[model samples]
Target: MDEAAVKEFIGTEISRSTVVVERSAIAFFASAVLDDDPVYTNADEASARGFEAIPAPPTFPFVMQNWGAFAELQAEGGQGAGLGMVLGPLMANGGLILHGEQAFVYHQPVLAGQTLTGVGVIKDAYVKESKGTTMTFVVAETTWSDASGAPVVTTTFNIIHRK
Candidate 1:
């Protein structure tokens, strides 16, 4: 299908997946990213420092949740318009004002060995004209919570599909 055809289909709710947080995964994330924060690395240090356990960095959940959602969306026959299609208008366009703006409220710090479930949904979609072409923006919002039903985090993303 063409870009406009896909853009028209943008408003559909895409997919959702749940992720269980694991200590090993957290450790690997911290180490791979070269983050030496004790709250993410050393459990003893975290406990000694008065945390429940090693807590993940604020943006760490994105690593675990967003990519999976994107993969699922693509696998379900979504096309990549471009980097802007995957990211947003700023990155796709040549504007110097591109910024990553995500608002997340953590009800509880993610602790080591805790399995957090992430529930994702494609929240909204719309088309906007840019220059001489049309761009479709899809917003996906995902909420993560512990098994006990306590909220963990929520991420709303804008994916722009250009035609």
Candidate 2:
């Protein structure tokens, strides 16, 4: 991909999605992630643990976009263009698009039965040369907020394009 294209993608809104946090989905996610915690499956257990409801496993928000909200957005006439829009150029160039890193900053515990809206932006993009290979790193940040419009969590992930 050219520098001009990369520059254009940086700081752009790549994705917007809204997800409903279902109790069943949280339980399923916990099982999938190998977290067999009682609080994730039983509301009573979660209540004893001082939670109002069953809490989603950590990293659950990462799937909120691709698994549900993105599909909904797509059905709404491609409103949620998502990360694909940001990585399309790099991917079209016949190179590898790889996940580099992911991080989450939680302002509140995400519990079941709440709705979250997320907006992701290409925060930064740059290129590095290593061992004669060109590597482009893109940083994307998404902020998830509750229905009341308060921030719930902020997630930052890096995608690397290598040629």
Best candidate according to lDDT: 2
Structural similarity to truth (TM-score) of each candidate? 0.66, 0.90
RMSD of 1: 6.7
Q: Which 10 consecutive residues of model 1 have the lowest summed lDDT?
A: 73-82
Q: Model 1: runs farther than 4 Å from truth? A: 1-13, 66-101
lDDT of each: 0.60, 0.83
For candidate 1, lDDT tens digit of each residue in 1-163? Answer: 2345444444444434545556767777888888877667777888998888777777778777533333432333443232343344334454232233455666778776666666555565555677976655566666777778788788666555555
Task: Write candidate 2's Cα lDDT for 25-121 as tens digits.
Answer: 8888999999999999999999999998888888999886645553553325454577788677678877888999999999999988777888889
User: Cα deviation of 116 in candidate 2 (Å)?
Assistant: 0.5
User: Backbone clashes in each candidate structure, one number apiece?
Assistant: 0, 0
